[model samples]
Target chain A: MIGRPTAIALIAVGVVLTATAMVLPWYSTAYGGGVEVVVRAWGTEIVNKPGDWPAGELSPWYGVPVAVTAALLVAGIWVARAAVAGAAGQAGAVGVTAALVVSERGHAVEQQGDFAVGFGLVFLVAGTLVALAGAVAVQREAG
Target chain B: MKKVLSVVLLVLAAGAAAGATLLPFSELLISLAPGQPQTAYVTTGWSTRFGGTKDEHGPLFGIPIVVAAAAVLVGVRWRKVAFAGAAALAGVAGMLFVHLLNVISFHEAGNIAIDPGLEAGFGNGIWVLIGAVVLAFGAVVVHPDD
Candidate 1:
């Protein structure tokens, strides 16, 4: 059996990773100039304009989502640790499914046209299968 | 205490997952129908960045959220719950990561427009987070052997 603190720690790591990914430095090409790299803040946008990479400022409102997600992750882990394994597993499954669905949509947007069609289908089908498998696995384990 | 907390978590998690899955549809239906002419809500910068007709990313993450919830509910032991929670966190992290990437892509694409519907995106994230927190609380309350 895993310890509560360890479970919480795992969740904390995930939250940090998610936040870092948002603020990490990303590189992209300029329209005419060489490639440019910049640090992406939590609530900002990076744009390549007129052959130059520029940072577009986003409203502080953007941070609301990040904060909310962080809170949820923390709470979910804490609750899962205290609850029975079965319940915890179910909660985790639901959370994971929601996350996967959102991620797939992002993937579709990233790749459009034929790519969207192919990749979207893959995400839908594959993601559903995976979620189902996870749920079933949890059920079996809990039982 | 463990059993009671487990049930509570299960119920809350299920409710949260349902809400996350359905909220988008309600928003779309209320906004997109030509006859209705109601304001549409857009979440994420995907539409702004990619120049798409609609934002289609939220539903994609739904699958994983459901999976993670299920995993947690069915786990029989503490180790299982830990693993499941870890997986759930990973899914949440992945979603956030992709959104960040989208921010970069939008920046690179050179078209950053704030969607009037951006509130919807924030709402979705907030709700999901709430569900996650509730589930976590339940876990804590139901600590096995208590």
Candidate 2:
């Protein structure tokens, strides 16, 4: 069975990572071509730095990582009150976080020749780990 | 009253899922130049198969959301329906999350055209579906077996 300490620890780590990602940069560009142009970029809600492209122009779902991170934080807090219910929330967080990271990473590796993984991504990885640990803890508690 | 609420939630969730399908999931812009931005709409079905798009993401999440909503509506009287509904809703959330990932990658890679600058992002429909799934999950959790 999972210990309360372990569960709390996982939740705590997830909370911190998700929170950190909210403020960190999500994406950046690395131009390889010999085009010497002052290219502008876009930013997201959490990473609201003045980039070339206007932020929030694409869609609302672009801020999903932030939303999911916030939800993970809430799930971490809820676990203390109810393991079963909290487990559900944590599972959702883990699944979504993993999906977002994997897809983005795939794109970076495959599509973007001069792409860099951002802090938001790092936080997503950390949060996913914590969420997985928390899920295991909940299962252990139940078993 | 609880059953009615559950039905309403399920219906809303299903409606949102349907709406999500109708809405554009992502916008792909192939900007070869500063003002010449070619935009394309990525939907959830057969359209994605063609039109220089490779999106295997939408249906992955869309089908489940619709199926789960239907299940919840039809089986609300079951003893474990609440748990089932919760699981389904959660599953929908997870899939949608993955869907976003696919979108990011699609945009990130922007490899369809050998363009240096590839711009991609999700549409509003996804958030609507995700929010509806959360609401439906909450409703099930609050009153299971309704």
Model 1 interface CAPRI class: incorrect
Model 2 regions lying over 4 Å from their true place: A23-29, A33-112, A135-143, B1-23, B26-40, B45-131, B138-146
How high is the TM-score of chain A in model 2? Answer: 0.56
Q: Which ten residues in a row have the lowest lDDT in candidate 1 chain B?
A: B24-33
Query: Tens digits of per-residue lDDT for model 1 on B1-146?
Result: 66666656655664565455444322221233334343543443122212245544444444555555555555334534534453454445344444544544443343333232222223354356445546644564465633
For model 2, the local distance difference test gives: 0.53
lDDT of 2 by residue, A83-141 (tens): 33333444444444344444445544564435455777577557656755675575456
Q: Largest DockQ belongs to which candidate?
A: 1
Error of 1 at B87 (Å): 8.4
Q: After superposition, how far is residue A70 of candidate 1 from its true place, in Å?
A: 12
Candidate 2: pairs in clash: A40-A52, A41-A52, A41-A53, A111-B109
Instruction: State residue B117's C-alpha deviation in candidate 1, in Å.
Output: 12
